[model samples]
Target: MKWTYTIQTEGLTVEQLLRDEWRLSKKQVHELRMAKGILDADETPIRWNEPLAAGTPVVIQLADTVSPHVPEPNPDVSIVFEDDHLLIACKPKGMPTHPNDPGQSGTLLNGVLGYVHAHGGTYAEHVHRLDQGTSGLVLFAKHPVVKNALDRMLEDRQITREYLAEVEGNIQKNGGTITAPIGRDRHHPTRRHISPSGQPAITHYSVTARRKGTTELRLTLDTGRTHQIRVHLASIGHPITGDELYGGAADSAGTYKLHAFRMTFIHPFTGKKLTAQN
Candidate 1:
């Protein structure tokens, strides 16, 4: 994969440009140096100590081999949106966002890296994360500046996220807001629960459909937290179907019925509104 960057300021060397301006890790810099992927705009070879001036463009090409941390890319991963700056993909159920163990593989990140490699992109920078069982849209930033900008937008809640979920039992209210504090479960290391000392979480939901034993809901989050929706819904006696970890009833579908259905946000680079859905 090849990436091009135009030098905006003067007096920076090639090495400084890669490390400070572009935010490439030391390992990546060393690899690029070894591969001689760093070159002038004219495609001429350049040394690490070469001085760069304003308007000079430098290109960095990534090696074809997949990173050791990620598994081989699988082409079957679904693509929802793609542009020069962003990639939105629908993560399949049962795929973790990233590998969590030494021998772990087959994660969404691995698949994304594979796609990027195949398509001539440089890297995968995730804007947000989803649980393993939740099938939904996942955003990937193509560069560092875009990733940084989106991170700020997420921190300010400028990104709008909508989800669809099927929960056990009928809800008494057609629409309501759930304000609760969520924190890590003291007993179970990987679970979350409501607690007084936890971070504040707010969920707004409207009943959309009713199955024989479950109600489908359109849910919006005011604050994103680990297991916020599951914990809040279970606290209100409507845990998601098939989510036994949170005391939910078994689902006939054999999979947790939750999907990140929609995301709307302003484009950081183009200053235009964008919406992506599953």
Candidate 2:
């Protein structure tokens, strides 16, 4: 489709015309140039070096066809809790919070934006994070005060997080604590491992049920670290079932059986204790 606009300036160069009259930015102009979308006032494709008179009428002929390689992303989200100052949601496993790679576009943020747009659009922000493969209750704030308060609580260990997981071995005791330091795996870029020289991490585990071959445990994190449950459990010889990273079964489809079961925190705005269990 060709859109025509009258040139107000009589003899400015085509570059100058685009510079002043284009609604999009200069970078957009360069992108349009790359797309071969820029044209002359005479409806001809103009060279980059071409100059134009100020008053020349410009015609920008855009193609009707859409680019096949570029896919349009739709925004979406699932709301777990909502109030004047915060919105909480359960992030599904295997979806990213934000776009990291070209393959990841439609994300939790996109969905939240769509939700905001639908509900009269309030000021909202994500306060914390969960890995792409972890599913859990995550909080978002409508006010910076709420966010800052939650950050303080998290820092102070006031927020309690409990998780459930099925691991490969039979956890001998009913409950035990793993006081290991966690650090990035030196050999693997995509995983975290326990090391003597890493940051302090405390993971408390209580055996919930014992399957003949596998043991299910409730893991409460004393200090949240990257892959703390999987790493700590594996450090003690019980890698999470299906967690292929720190060594678990790849044969079963139900591997890496970790679930965020409960979260406890005082309401940032109301000053009341609030708990969400999933």
Candidate 3:
């Protein structure tokens, strides 16, 4: 894979661009250096420690490797946003974000791999994931550097993800935050619950609308624990409608009413604020 960027800041060294700006891993930087991947516009290798002036074009080339996901194209997979560095795709409900095992087909990642291949690209990877019962926009990285950067951004809470859900009961408060720890439920496999000895989880929610027996909510998270939103809402006695596992009423479709409605973050390379909505 090869990408080119024009130096925007004066006197920026390749080392700074890779380590400070892009946040590439030390191993990745060393590999790039060993491969002579950093080059000038003329395709000649450049000194990593040498400072380059503004407007200087730099090219990066890396060994091409195809994604491991088995491509199974599905029309349901929708690409909402795409660039050389990143992609935002809408994941349909009832599909796992990625395969649980190698060579698994029919997953969202497989479909994304199919899309990438169709576009003549050799690499694609999901940065985060959505629950199988929920539908939402998922972010993907087109390269390793951006993937590492996005992973760090998510860990630092620099990326904002907003969710919408219909719960079983009306909430009196206009807005509130849930600050509970979440851990695995010992009684049930694949279930999470609030526990005193668990990882800290925080969710902020506001009432959006009230129906006859359900309430719509807009929620944001400060931490992404497994089933954090579901566990938090259930703990407050407002289990999400159609969330049968959480003691809420069942849906006709047999899936929960949760949706990742929006995501906002700064582009790793372009430094532009970008938003994607489902």
TM-score of each: 0.76, 0.68, 0.97
TM-score of 2: 0.68
Give the alpha carbon lDDT tens digit for every residue of 47-133 in model 2.
Answer: 755666645666655443221111322433567778755787777777666555554446665566556556654445566667676
Alpha-carbon lDDT, every model: 0.81, 0.69, 0.91
Off by over 4 Å in 1: 1-68
Candidate 1 local Cα displacement, residue 260, angstroms? 0.5
Ranking by TM-score: 3, 1, 2
Candidate 1, residues 1-278, lDDT tens digits: the string is: 46577776797888886666545556667777888887888877687897778788877664544344554577657888888778898888888887777656688877887788787755776789898889899888776545666776788898998999999998978999999999999899899999999999999999999888889999999999998899999999999999989998776676788899899998764557999998
> Candidates 2 and 3: which is better by TM-score?
3
Off by over 4 Å in 3: none
Off by over 4 Å in 2: 1-77, 101-104
- Candidate order by lDDT, decreasing, is 3, 1, 2
In candidate 1 the C-alpha lDDT for residue 236 amounts to 96
lDDT of 2 at 126: 62
